[model samples]
Target: MTFRTRFAPSPTGPLHLGHAYSALIAAQEARAHGGEFLLRIEDIDQSRSRTHWEDQIYDDLAWLGLSWPRPVMRQSERTKAYARAVAQLTDAGLTYPCICRRADIEAAAGAPQEGVPQFGPDGRIYPGTCRARVFPESQDHAIRLNMAKAVEGLTELSFVEKGALFAGAHRLDAARLVETIGDIILVRKGMAASYHLAVVVDDAEQGITQVTRGADLWEATQIHVLLQRLLGLSTPDYHHHDLIRDDAGKRLAKRDDARAIATYRADGATPEDVIEMVGLTP
Candidate 1:
């Protein structure tokens, strides 16, 4: 492996401390191992993604003493590729239209099971309300992967994890994926594809040999595994690193503008301050 890694962030808002830590660690890892470090703009959500935020991302990373090659990858320009992946799954009988609303899926997932919340990588496990419906393209519906069928179609699956706690390789069970992940969104209404699908496709296309991200995405790897298998893509080594939290122990979010890298710079905080804040330096 070439130890390739990336720091992909959606340009919906300014880069926060959490984003900085992940980016810094990924770049450091690639450098330490003599590998390539890539930056990707996950700006597929055109409705929310802003060019100003993208510009801030560059400034933030540069201030943190990170550099990358020219021509960074942007998800917005790769819709056609994502569409082809979606079409493959749909034609292979592994995907169906999902027209259920969030409220509807929540109600169904919690139907008659109080106090036992159903959750997936993105929060609630979709109840698969429209998994069986073969709706017309004229109807407004998102495409969802048929987890049950998709898992059965694949043989034994596994992935590598480099996190300190769960370090080493990990094996994926087909039955657990169907049970825990349920059916996940592939393509949204009038969009290219969901984050799960786009990421799975993008990583392979980018030749990313190592995925260094937050531990919050560990569970989502199961869903990505299914997509990788379905699309015949190569799986990469995953390094789910620790998350950066505030004094109150809450994880940082894009809405936490006070913790934004740009804000810190304006407040007289140096790059060393950020490195120290994230405990990446002594």
Candidate 2:
């Protein structure tokens, strides 16, 4: 298969140094392998997604000397696809509706059983309060994959990792997934789909052979792999690279406007300079 990768970013904020590093790394990898590098707009959360920020993403990436084929794949326009995937999972009895809010989960997890994990990849591993509840027709709720049900009969679950950390073949533990990850949200309330569900479906549709991103997302790869198996999608190779950090050694975020690519450009920094700042070759 032809090698393919992508740089997917939410247009809710500015593309910072970390974003530059990831995009450059993906584009560089594609070039080195004589493959294709794609850009995806992860704007599923339309409430925060803005046209101006999306425009700035293109501007900033172009200013950094990176280019990709257009028109780009925007998540907002792919809700029907996400809904279909959700419907498939639901029909297979691998999904359930969840009406529990954040506060409710916290209260339920307050008194945990001994040796039970308090957190997982999806943050505060779902308490499964709504796992046995029937799907309410008129009530608003999110959808969650039943981890235990999803992993049934699925042995030999693994993926290739080409990143710096954990660079090798890794197998997923089914029991660990149930205990730690729990039933993660596939579709969030008031949103078309959660990141986990959307990304897996999008990667398959885009024919992405490899997924490149920051190391912070390493833990979440297992979830994606599981979803791929459940959805009968192909699992891609993964490259989780180092993250760009601030002076204090913390990873850069969209909120860190000082480290934004646009800020550097405004301060008269060139594309080469920005690339060098992120420890990449021009």
**Which residues of candidate 1, in runs, are more than 4 Å off?**
110-117
RMSD, every candidate, angstroms: 1.6, 1.0
Candidate 1 C-alpha lDDT tens digits along 50-165: 99999999999999999998799999999999999988988988888888888787677655466443776856778778876776778898888888888875777888898795
lDDT at position 203, candidate 2: 98
TM-score for candidate 1: 0.95
lDDT tens readout by residue for model 2, 1-282? 889999999999999999999999999999999999999999999999999999999999999888998999999999999999999999999998899999999998878778879998899998789988876568999989999999888899999999878799999999999998999999999999999999999999999999999999999999999999988998999999998888899999899999999999999999999999989889
Per lDDT, the best of the predicted structures is 2
**Each prediction's TM-score against the native?**
0.95, 0.98
Worst 10 residues of 1 by lDDT: 109-118
C-alpha lDDT values of all predictions:
0.87, 0.94
Q: Candidate 2: minimum summed lDDT over ten consecutive residues — where?
A: 130-139
